[model samples]
Target: MAFWTYMLKCADGHFYVGHSDNLEARIAAHQSGTIGGYTHSRRPLELVWCETFGSREEALAAERQIKGWSRAKKRALIAGDWDLISELARCRSRG
Candidate 1:
């Protein structure tokens, strides 16, 4: 079974991160407001980034790590800017 770590760009311009075994169903739930909570009010979300993982643990780990990231780092991740992400991490560690 495959797991997924996904990021949604919400209507409020903030990002929501999550992981699920059923990516399509989970996303649909969020879109329909059935998922509720943070994403329910921030509707009309756009899926900006996603990655598949071999296990639920991996996907959950990714989700948790992403949730802690700064907005700039998250943007860098969405943009696939590994260099920028690394630089940002270094800057964060130095501070």
Candidate 2:
């Protein structure tokens, strides 16, 4: 089974990171406020990005890593700007 790491753009213009084996169902839960947490309250979410992994561990690791990123870094990822992603990582390492 493939696991997925996904990002949601919340009502308040913030991002949420999550991983699940059933991406569609998980996003549905968040959208319906059934997820019952940050995304729940934020409401009206839009899935901005998703990446599939071969294993649950890989998906979870990607989720955790993305969660620690700055908003700009996340935006870069959502835009599929690989150059900016690498530049941001370098800047983060320097500062």
Whole-model Cα lDDT per candidate? 0.97, 0.96
Put down candidate 2 lDDT per residue, 1-95, tens digits, no spaces. Answer: 99999999999999999999999999999998888878988989999999999999999999999999999999999999999999999999999
Runs of candidate 1 with Cα error greater than 4 angstroms are none
Q: What would the TM-scores of all predictions be?
A: 0.98, 0.98
Question: Distance from true position, residue 11, model 1, in Å?
Answer: 0.3
| lDDT at 32, model 2 | 88
RMSD from true fold, candidate 2: 0.5
Candidate 2 accuracy as TM-score: 0.98
Residues 1-95, candidate 1: write the lDDT tens digits. 99999999999999999999999999999999999799999999999999999999999999999999999999999999999999999999999
